[model samples]
Target: MNAAETPRRGHCSDFEAPVYRNRWRSLALALTGSLLALVPAAPTAGEIYRCARQDGGAPLYTDTRCDAQAQPVPSRTPPTIAANPAPDLAARHDQRLQREHERRQALDARWLAEHHRAAALDQRIRQAVVEGRVVAGMSAAQVRQAWGAPDQVIPQVGDGAPRERWVYRGDRDGTGTRSVQLEGNRVVGSGRRAPEAPSTPPRTTPPR
Candidate 1:
């Protein structure tokens, strides 16, 4: 056969076929990438914008912004109703008053209960003082047993701790009365007040 009709020795169709197939693969890959870039992405939960035209047509809602004034709108959600017209002023005022009255009643009940308790405690302590049975550094249980109930119990605040001061008098003056101070439900001290020292004039040499 003539050389022109025979296949070349050094050049084979197998090599050319592989190169041609490779070029086709690269072209296919480029086309696929371009198509992916042009495609839109999945829709997000971002707010949709509503645009109004100068001609007063129906508003247009779009994900893309418009040259006109754009207002935000929900994509799939229903429009929300207003907050019930804020309960007319009179109704609001009445509701507020009712709440305030309820709060005040709760406070009053609590305060009255506390006052009654204080009065009862004071009575117990006064009875104990009359009997003269309680002493200093006595536990609450011991005091309750020996001193009896107090005339009244008044809470005291001192030194970042709660204290109880048993202070009262059997007479108009504080004579024959004892003062007791309690902390942590235990009597810390108890005693009568000391008498004040009498004032006296200083001795002076007589003027000659």
Candidate 2:
């Protein structure tokens, strides 16, 4: 070789040495990354925090404490309930209805008894009328029982007995007058009279 070629070859050798060094550095970095991937990561210690929303919204959970509207999470459990409860609503309702039914039954029985008593009293009055037992010595109530009410009752004085005459005047055309006399509450007598004659004098004697 030439004396000048020696220097040029030395410079080429220097450039090629830097390229090999760069390749060796890249290979070392790749091997270090693979080794790191194989090694297990350590577990991090974290605190649980609960964050509140602006309105009624989904709750947020985070490992770090929140600065706005946040609180540490608390443990929660379900509430305990009794196995055997008190009487239910349906049972109480049924009892109330039963009591009302009994009350109505009692009222119905009392009304029926009163109705029977009135009917029996009416029957006794009819029997007295049929037997013609409404007479002197019978009470005024007994007279009323047989004849119901009279059309007129007139009081009399200046007589043998303080008396009241009850008159039943038939409808017009002068049919007649049926009268019952009572001294106090006792019936003294009862009779019917012919219609008055315009020319005849009134009778002073009580009817027999």
Q: Tell me each candidate's TM-score.
A: 0.29, 0.32
What are the lDDT figures for the candidates, one per model?
Answer: 0.72, 0.76
Q: Residues 1-208, candidate 2, lDDT per residue (tens digit)?
A: 8885575643547668899889999999999999999875432355567776788699788765566445557646679887887778898899999999999999999999989987886676567767744666667777777666878999988556678998888623558878888997778788888877679788799889
RMSD score of candidate 2 (Å): 18.7
Query: Model 2, which residues run further than 4 Å from truth?
Result: 1-87, 133-208
Model 1 C-alpha lDDT per residue in residues 33-100, reported as the tens digit of each score: 99999875543458677778779999887776564445457557679877765558898899999999
TM-score of 1: 0.29
Clashes of each: 15, 0
- Residue pairs with colliding backbones in model 2 are none
Predicted model with the maximum lDDT:
2
Poorest lDDT segment (10 consecutive residues) of candidate 2: 39-48
Model 1, position 140, has a per-residue lDDT of 72
